[model samples]
Target: MTVYRPPARKRLTQDERRAVYERCNGHCAYCGFELETMHQLHVDHVIPMEFYELYEVEGYDLDSMDNFLPACCSCNIYKHTYRLEKFRAAIERMPDVLQRDAATFRHAVRFGMVEIKQHPVVFYFEATGVDVPSLHWDAEIEKKYRTGEQK
Candidate 1:
């Protein structure tokens, strides 16, 4: 979706992804990929506070750096939103969605747990006008987090 920044969600003091790596020992909580060895890494919001209807980060803002993390491309795409309740309902009967390697209050994304389809995530790119796909999210995310690049 189109991420609308109201000047507040626009910036942060320190590097978010680097911080997450330090916080989580360079391991993606979702995919458990070690950033130390990974070619590219992504810093994603554990809870998507930036609401969206079709495009843009809208509605109530919860732009906290603590919500960010170092995640693999797969996990970040799957755990895109904070509406875990809806996910629970959507993937209900599939006990796999309920299973987590570790407990997370708002975000418990385990990468490679399920074969997350690309269609749903492709909607976000279309809405946001971003060209990055699941295959390239890692590189794209790293660029954004490290050097503040957006395309």
Candidate 2:
């Protein structure tokens, strides 16, 4: 029952950005693309900040290090304000998007970094206290990979 909006601050300080890049090992969280090879890389909110504001929840800070992830230009642009599940679903449905970044998507799935759930989507990162119904992914697709059908 909430409308999504883009984050207000589009750029991070050089130090902040550098820290995130180093923390993520210079690789995109969504696509695993190397930052060195890409012309631009973005710092993405793992659990979008829009959700935090919409819900007016407690203890969720979007600017914190725990919530940040390195993302390549393509993935960041495509992701926009969609939640993790919605973004992952887009990767699965779109051939062009998937063809280049399936490995990263699969890796996130394998490691439980991203989850699939229906209805009001919520991705809870325990460390960050991010529990909100703003992100989404398909449980069926997750099952396919978990069962080794898609692997």
Using TM-score as the measure, the top candidate is 2
1-151 in candidate 2: lDDT tens per residue?
A: 9866645754677887887777546777666677894336687877666666633334345556666777888888888888776876776666444435788876776798866443432222332343322232234344655888732
- The per-prediction CA RMSD against the true structure, in angstroms, equals 16.5, 14.0
**Model 1, total clashes:** 3
Tell me the lDDT of model 2 at 57: 37
- Per-residue lDDT for 2 in model 2? 86
TM-score of every candidate relative to the true structure: 0.41, 0.54
Q: lDDT of candidate 2?
A: 0.62
lDDT of each: 0.47, 0.62
| Model 1 lDDT tens row, 7-93 | 444454446546655555666654456667434566665446444221232222345453455666766776677443453344443
